[model samples]
Target: MSTTPVSEPMAIDSRSGSAAIIATEPAAQNSNHSCRDADLISKYDVSGPRYTSYPTALQFSETYTEATYRQQAQVNLKQGIAPVSLYVHVPFCQNICYYCACNKIVTADRSVARTYLDYLHKEISLQSELVGKYRPVTQLHLGGGTPTFFDGAELTELMHLLASHYNLSDSEQREYSIEIDPRTVTQDSLALLKGLGFNRLSLGVQDFDEQVQRAINRRQSVAMIKTLTETARLYQFKSVSYDLIYGLPLQTPASLAETLATVIDLSPDRIAFYNYAHLPQRFSSQRAIDRLDLPSAQQKIAMLALIAEQLTAAGYRHIGMDHFVKPQDELARAQQAGKLQRNFQGYSTSLAQDLVGLGVSSISSLHASYAQNERDLDAYYQRLDRGELPISKGVELTVDDQIRRQIIVQLICNLQLSIASIEKQFAIHFSEYFSQELLALQLIENDGLLSCEGDKVIIHERGRPMLRNICMCFDRYLPQGATASFSQTL
Candidate 1:
């Protein structure tokens, strides 16, 4: 129940009025540490989408009309090649956290949530019309501004609306999941979630240290989180994941290590150790944090190394960047078997063909294109009220976009890419078709970040920590001087 705020150093630029920039001293000038050079960071930290989708959401064009999205949905439904995965964004939080960068609005109005729910149901009906009849849903994820912000009745109503239209088969058990705020959940809430068929829960436990918690304006305790975990398990939650952050205000190696040790004791099936990307410009609430109270670059790197070492020692397998799982967890197994896939949601075990996103500001992906709903809440509701799909922008990927995406996904998910395999599958010679991208890889290889053996380009273990940098080689839409769109790759 401790609510004391933790103080930190001043390396983060809080007044930048843009994404908060955490300044890090360039690594020591040595051949082995060349990857940390200023030139390398400057070159790789360019503005590009995180590639959750092939044509990244930023690349989505205004030309994607409602008709286009409906047409695409019809074709995919007719093909019946893969089960659909649905993501619903609930963007209302009772209070704002200084460190939160997610697209959310702070409000205590229950009526707002209720009205949003009604519009969500309308959007669901709109989507159903496009796909026609029921298609078995394989996955359903409810994300942000605290999905539990709505009561159990609202959650059940939303799920029932989806199930009624999509038709979940008995044999096709859905991977129903939701993100829970530790400060918000109660016994009744947990019971309602279980009754509504939510089998997975992801709790946001940034840090257990009271000082750090206060610094970020997110106050919670180890005891409360432990109780929440126990409650979820008691309610038959199949998988529980905890989200942890590194390099936050008032964070130190010892403090973070102690937090991780305690988290391991809770024994959640998965952990996401995300780096604190201090972007105040993109998120105004972050402006409340003092920039002087952040960690140094060297400290940040050490903290990351420490987290990896401790998690690995605790028998958790590192599944690419920022995620770890127990050996029995499906994510780890998928990584080992090369079945891992990345989407708008960081990493996924389900191999659903298309992602249909509902709610304001959500994005969806299909075989040939990517589309995003309008980000403005009023705009989203207006479109739905007008009997529209709320689709504001999208991109139709070319054949080249598809091929490059395949290569990028393999590198990001598996840390290995075979040029010959890519060539054979796409019917294009890698060296000839992607000359510039290959040249970029050569620069990375020369720096010891990657290596080429025969026709395969493999990222070294050291390089694996910087997977985003490696993937930047193939991005076709990297804009010049657009450095503020994404968080740091470190």
Candidate 2:
């Protein structure tokens, strides 16, 4: 009875308040990092941090109080403000997907959204004031139970609120995106998002199989998504991405092959292929899913292979872990230039170093720390009412944390890490500083997961799925078996 460790969709996985899980390379030259390497993968397929940050969300602490967050923000403000990114969390959802692990609200009361947005506006003003009202916003994301849950007017108002408070970028190069639940949006909604200055759309298309949709309680027709993708293209939305998950109830590799067939037919500009993390205890909605119908770990591996092979064959580039993009996509080009990055939003171009997360449970990575707002709605509103930033917990990066972060981000984003470069930048001998991490890498290196040359460690294409396991060696905070608390890295 081999079980796959559960992994949350990177969408809200950061809980730090980024939106959308980003991911790719060109069509002409296939990296062939495809499904053929599943055998090697099964051996290293274990649970570990996604490494969206070096010290992941698990390291956030109450000791780093709201005051600490404010202090950091003020420090950065005085040191010379940097351009920033924004992630707004919309916690409402009209329905529940049994396998979902995001922080979301289930309600038919549309009025609740109006109330949430009102509080969010207050948060925007407070955060902008602290983070710097005139800082250029080079990137923006709207993540949620479903960002589209807000009516067109409400969505418009939300954008206006952000624009009025912060320096919103109207440049053609700014990466503005929002997550869309097909069930919650229409062509008008897409039009509205573009008019609001969002150039990207992330569609939640978990799996189109009728049986899979019923089991997960998220049903949307292929016709619906096709229409939206077409409309997004027609409207010239810079990029349209789809979110697809594997290892759900009743999913077979063959079924996913069919799903990919349809997915390829529609051909989204980018796709986030995630594994379904089935932890019933943590996410109550998952308790609604019966464990028996879930795919075996091995089956899930095969499904991973199927996705890689098919998408690559269709001329999509396998860029980072779980993301495939067409050759011409900006993300692919960014990866080639070693500028792709991962945050709460998963994979993205490194548009800005500081990000401000607004709304309850949204996480902000700024002021040399990662700060999270109150997790629940009540505490969020309570803090805002008191005229305070709703930040509840966070971690400031130490020199070691920053060093380790650079190493991890380089490997995950650029597919290779320059040991010499790291040593030079940090002014430390790599071998002496990470002596134990290097010794531990013996097993990983022998397994052909990566290679250690004079001053470089290269992650082989086939070894990409095992990235979490490799990175765990450098994690100071990850105790043995602590991975049980995280989603698996299949």
Candidate 3:
């Protein structure tokens, strides 16, 4: 591991002392990326795609078919590509949470999941045949409506099927992660997961306060989280991450401050402080939430400020965007090494260039294109039953798309963009190719968010908080009209 301390440039905040600036170096390792410009945050906190993918999933279309994905797979196999990542989505949830935007099937019927599991295995087999059976998988993530919603035997069968068809890496160093709902999994169930080869666990604990939990209809207790975390540690899971959302209903500064204090005390390996995007029109479950109960934009910003202060004070490294980690965690390590990657699965330490997404609404990102399984479970099963890949939509990258992707990835993941590197990779004069963009970025530059030297564009401390705004300066496909489809960046 590289011991060279990282020097991240950051904006200073008066509220949090020096920990508000420059979240870099071992001494300041727990410092926040301290830009506290609420005015700027509010001004630039417009709806935008998270850019987990450069083009974003908004560009995926039905035009790019299963044949296109198959061709890409064949090309990958012929070239003897590196080990790929696998993302399996389990869309079954026993109940719905009001804040959820994920594609899910909510039901009381346990039998529904059994059928879904059978189809998931079939889809896995079909993908293996195209991508070549037993190709090494360096990273595997089981995400869901709730992955632990299935019984132990179902999960065991799922893993067995994966092992049988895919070259599942047994190396302890490889990442095998699963998302678990604390309300669903017990200590024995966690043990079952550890036995089945999952080493990383992400627990969904939106809030521990009973009021907030009740408002969101996810009534998990603080004790539930405490016990589950302790159990995960007992099993020696490599990493345990807790997920929290800031801008939800009933999230007052005092309430959230208490929540953060409790979370910090627990001291999970990683934390994701998400800004809840309340789009009732887009996600039906959200409609059930009373709009009047939702926090105002100003309150949301305050909640974010509290998050920055509390987490940084508790000695957590603000990795990027809404993610934080212990200074020694792989995510922090990856950030220091410039090897961190942003994908549909958020930040990943995996070096694999290709990711095969299995199950409903999952997305597979190839070298030159992106594919998504059908969002509707019935449609997804219908296609698989017909012995066809369930790729309902996708998009192939254009040359310009590829260039923009490289630039955006470097800037978002590392907080800096080397003009020469982009120029060399894309074979274009940086200034010449992005002349209009540079002209537009004068707005950001003038606002003290970033600085553009002769050969590099460096995100200034003030710009760190509005990283999305800085990244948006390079998005060529951003719609000029209304932006209701995306979430607020702050």
Candidate 4:
């Protein structure tokens, strides 16, 4: 890692003591002069899933039904397992960010949000009826298209409706989290959210540079973010996180470095430095961005290295794959204890029995299967109006799917896989069951990305930056020649 000189230390106020600050220098020029000779960018920039979930969302089929989902929920609940987590996806955003590929609907109709909330409540009740009343909810997350798009009262009602059915206790052990757009949040909104039991806030601060923000069509000033962070802290939010992206349009090394310098001064508990993936054909919004404004592959790589160096020097732990957290944050602690987990929400400290998702385009996971709600709002409401569950498509995991999912999750979350543990748990010889995957991993091992000792495969630190590439070796459903179907691994 490269080092940058700090002229002075800046102090940022925190609930605990002050946060340390360190200056960051502009990214050094890429040293890979031979990349052009071998066409390395084209070779390694193949389409791939981010592996947020094993068997990626693409594998979800139309064969599974609502009844199957209910059955699975009941069985899991009856096993007296730990409480499950809940994720509510509010898909409406007022404006479009060109770089975002998340499932979202851009609309300004407030009535649509209201109608959607009604259906969301019904779905919560349906799942509650199946899982029984006493099943405690250990974690609850409200994700976007800007979850804060709803007004204060609307948000409060949604929280109350879910809390009523799921029995959320006012305990610190339970993590209640939400995503917010800094441009949309208000002091009242933050207070309302805090009162409704949301203890964590993740502000979308993709790039502080004005030109970069304009290129992505997401314009929010650094002062706006600072005010929002200050207000969230005043409301006593347990943790504050910021999301930053490299490789976006108009993001030169100097501009991104300046943005990082400003961000470190704010001292969020967690930071996610993500890669901007441009897939115009799949995501129409991205087509609006001028490709010429974007950074090159080498520049993107340099920016990532710069972020790692600056953040590490400022006392943040690189908690694996695109996430950094202060040493005192629960995520960092969980990582140290080997209890960190990765879900659709990125890194988390919660280990719930399962995840129950509500609303259109939401996804749920039980031990036996994974189910998804209807993707279209019209279809979702029609199902609920007919007194039916809103699930349109899902996949019932076979015994093999379950075993493979466990292995993938372990590798992605913990960076280590034990073949013996998998065999003992699933009652199958690891080599016989995963012969093809092992062969693919061997190829990656030859490339110095991983090490295989006996039946165990460990991803080295060098491989950590390319964790997604390693995970793809085990993805069974990735269609052959699916070049334009997914995003870049970097």
Candidate 5:
């Protein structure tokens, strides 16, 4: 949310582009030791913020009004207004995947999607007007309960609508991606997506084991995903990403190994190997999953290690927490060039400083503030029907918030923190400003999880799996025992 620099003193980004932090020679193999440390796993694998945004969305309050959101939208955010990224959250899904924790509506009726698209038109028009209509949209992502829920004609309409409202880029360098459910897309739909200017594909292939699939209520075959992967390449989609999850309802190292073997044969350009967090109380759909069937903590840790070892051996570069990419992928290149940044949508190429999120329950990241649309369907529609922004809650970052945000994002993305660079940028002594937080980190520093010397906080291999716990020390809002709401780090 901290959009701009304070008097140009606070460095804008942690990348080498800014005078903030310099990255160490990052090795994908560094994290192989993380899962091996039983003590390390037991001590630090607790609930905490993922640091996609500092002052995480939990800090968002209703007091932050639509007026404040509008004011910031009109103000050209940090670095003199370059291009912006767009994230459109489609809320409707025909069937529910029990493991999913995203904001979505599950229903058999198809009419709801049509209704949602109509209201999206009004929201898109309003958003384009507030944020500049001419600002080149270099990045566009369609995330959802299921973005592929719409038919070909409906999806074509959505792309056309976005093009009309904003200066959607046709540049080869642009990143236009969508999240797809393997069951929802057809050969024609996949072709239509490529024709519609989406160059990237992120497929949700939670697991390939049919039994595990049935246990989670998502029954897609490895053959189905194989066909889709082949078709994606034939259509010349720039990147194909597969989202795989571990610690599911019915899974073991042997089953996961088979799944990974199938995935490797179908080699996606990028793979996000996620740690499954079963919080049944937080999500009703997950209640269907029997807790007894879930993998043990030790097994989950072994699974994580297996993923890292297997992917790296297969020549995929592990980028940040859960993402693994081919050496030639844009993400790997971005990391090497120090142009990577983490957002609500995992890791990004840092093409734009501001990301505009539209549709119900979507959150937009402006330079100084974060804002969200009405979370409830009725509330969202009623506000839009009255020709108003469907805002609900958000938070504007303070100067202190900005400093900690850079620290967390740097540690998360690059695996190192440059304390001297941060001090120079924010015009404060890092040690003195964060005296208490430093003390909290000392215990872990002694454990050799991280090296917090005079000017650097370098996360070693053992610390990679504990990234959330490391970042949690800097969170002002996340006090002790307040982690009941979050998922485990491992």
Candidate 6:
């Protein structure tokens, strides 16, 4: 599984964010990292973090408290870290999916949502006091148990409350997105979201096969998705993304291929084809699934191959990791321009310096530290009721961590890092500061994952999927035997 760098630069499509159809190199040249190669995938299909954040969320601890969050929030605000990003978590879901791992509450009670919304508004106000009510919010994301679980009026009220406290961006360039359970969202609901300035929608459609859907306890028809897609398009939403999962119970190569085919027909602007990490020991909902019914490692690899082949054939450019998008999409543009970023919300085009997370189990990444809110619903409520921030844990980054973070981000986003730039920025010799890490990377380099060309380390095309493995060598706190806790790297 090795490759030589192409003599010409790999094709990066110039058509907005369109597919980078590399004509100079044979498709098979990158097969070892492609979704179509089973043997290649099986060999490196090991567990690893997604690297959404440097040091990763698993490193968070109780030592970082609410007071710590407040102090950092104040500092970031007073120092003018403007045009920040906000992630609002809605942890309530009407039903549970057997394979879900998110922090969520399952209930059919409307009262629960009402109470939660009230507290969420309160938390927003409290945070505004610390960070100021008028800081420009460049991006606002609603992620959840099912953000659409709220009625139209409730959602409108929530939006109004946020606008009252935060000086949200008025420019069309701002990204206002929300995750929706298509089953619960209606045409009217879609209109409401559009009217409220939510320009992007991420729909959860793990699989369309009836048997597979039943096995995961999430049964939604292809017709439902078609209707939703049509409505979203009719409303002229800026971007519509569909989320699909592989490795669920009863999922086979054939079933997954069919799923991919249907997803391609839907023609979403973006697709997130994720590998389902079945960790029943960690997520209680997973206990409902039959492990014996899950796909074998080889089968999972085959499924991955099929997904890559199908989506690539459908004209979606691989934007790294599980995300693929039309080249003209903003994400593709950012990737092409080397300004793409990864955060708790996954890949984003926003370059905001600070990201504030509100609601239970939400995590905030500030300029100097990472802070997470209380994971327990009762505890979060109690703290907020007492007029206190609900922060539970976080870590403050040191100079070394910051340097490694910048390097990892560069590699992950652009697949290249300039040693001279890093050395000049950090005021240290690159070889001297990361001698040990460079030594470790030699193994991957020998495998053709990357090459150190004097002052730069360029990740070859075949190495794109293994970005996590490459970045892990730089993590200071990656403990032995901890890899098993994370999902398999595809």
Every candidate's lDDT: 0.73, 0.79, 0.76, 0.72, 0.79, 0.76
Task: Give lDDT: candidate 5, residue 262.
Answer: 87
State the lDDT of candidate 1 residue by residue for 429-467, as single tens digits: 788998998898888888777787788887765565577
Give the residue spans of candidate 3 off by over 4 A: 1-38, 480-482
For each of the candidates, the C-alpha root-mean-square deviation to the true structure, in angstroms, is 6.7, 4.2, 6.3, 7.7, 5.3, 6.5
Expressed as tens digits, the lDDT of each residue in 118-154 for candidate 6 is: 9998899988787767778888888876777788988
Q: What's the residue-level lDDT of 277 in candidate 6? A: 73
Clashes by residue pair, model 3: 10-461, 11-461
Candidate 6 lands at a TM-score of: 0.91
TM-score of each: 0.89, 0.93, 0.92, 0.89, 0.93, 0.91
28-104 in candidate 3: lDDT tens per residue? 33234334455676688787766667676677789999999998888878747478888888877887788877767
Kindly list the per-residue Cα lDDT of model 2 for residues 160-257, writing each as its tens digit.
Answer: 99989999998888889888889888898888889999998888888989999999998899999999999999999999888888898999998999
Clashes of each: 12, 8, 2, 0, 2, 5
| Candidate 3 positional error at 281, Å | 0.6
- lDDT over C-alpha atoms for residue 406 of model 3: 84
Candidate 6 regions off by >4 Å?
1-43
Task: Tally clashing residue pairs in candidate 2.
Answer: 8
Identify the runs in model 4 with alpha carbons over 4 angstroms from their true place: 1-43, 479-483
Relative to the true structure, candidate 2 has a C-alpha RMSD (angstroms) of 4.2
TM-score of 1: 0.89
Which 10 residues in a row give candidate 1 its minimum summed lDDT? 15-24
**What lDDT is reached at residue 141 by model 3?**
81
